[model samples]
Target: MIRRSILFCLMIVFAVSLCACHKENPDPSGQNPDSSPTPTTPDTVTIAPVISGGGINLVAKLIYTVDASTAKVVRSTVMVRDDTDITPALVIDCIVESLKDESLNLSFDGIEYSDGVCVVDFDDSIFTIAGKSADLEDAILDCIAQSVLDNVDGCMKIIYRIHNEAYSTVNRHFAYDFVYMDD
Candidate 1:
């Protein structure tokens, strides 16, 4: 008689469960009404770089040497602190700044890289202008050539000009066409 009572209760519970499961469970497509919308990403982001390493090695040529009989363009290494920037302009500017001083008679108007060559605009008319001696011009050109070859990268050769125009006879012998041969 006790077994019969237990079996009757189990059958009643099963019937109640079947009725509890509704046929339309919120249409299966739309949200549950309590949920929120999905998020989207932003359009653009601008951030500065946190650079590492000590930075690049540069060579600053000695522009002023009284003993111009020998090579005056003595190059030495300089370590640039590139904490946040490494653009070509920045690097070139740094090189020019490193080259600056009263004794060093060299100055750069500007420097830019395009296509394949790096154009270096020099501000030193002291050598390229009216009636400077050819030897002086040659020495200056040599210094400029060596400096560019030692410091800059990516370009096969460097092109130097004063005020954007090529130097007359100097470009023939001691040209800015210093080609980089890989070691």
Candidate 2:
């Protein structure tokens, strides 16, 4: 008798669940109210990235190194959005893309961020920017350093490396090893 009572209760619960599963939608349109798709908008200034990781897709003020002959400042503020994960390396890549007529052709091999300091390892391609005047190289580095510092939160310093090895100078001009956000 107890077994029959348990089986009967189980049968009732099964029927209730089946009924719940087939219930009609309250909306006359037959669409689930919560299943509407959210709209997405692209970043305001869509510049094609030379080295694409993906888009940051947010409008932001970025510092770009420009030809000093044409610009009032060597490094000027510009509004732009480009592809990347907002990491130090990607932000530097975006800065490279923004450079006027100077093709540095550099990329980061690895990047590590911790406690507001970002250590960036680069391939030997970093030397490609050499032979440019020391001041121009400094401007380029400043552009990269300042852009990452302004965009990525909590990143207060950037240390340079060649294939994970420490470097004291880059492009034979600017002092490397570290760039302070405060500077």
Check candidate 2 and list the clashing pairs. Answer: 54-83, 54-84
| Segments of candidate 2 deviating more than 4 angstroms | 1-58, 66-85, 168-183
Candidate 2 TM-score, true structure as reference: 0.52
**Full-model lDDT for every candidate:** 0.50, 0.62
TM-score of 1: 0.42
Candidate 2 lDDT by residue in tens digits, 1-183: 999999999999999999989967699998877897876743465555568875444465556564644322255444544443467766666666765255446566887888888876767655655444556655655666677787787788877666776653544422455463443
Candidate 1 lDDT tens digits, 1-183? 999999999999998898888577674775577778776632332333357644343322222222244424545444444333334455454434544442334556777776556676766544542244555455555554555454445545566666666644533433445432221
Top lDDT: which candidate number? 2
- Poorest 10 consecutive residues by lDDT, candidate 1: 58-67
Query: Which runs in model 1 stand beyond 4 Å of their true positions?
Result: 1-71, 82-102, 128-133, 169-183
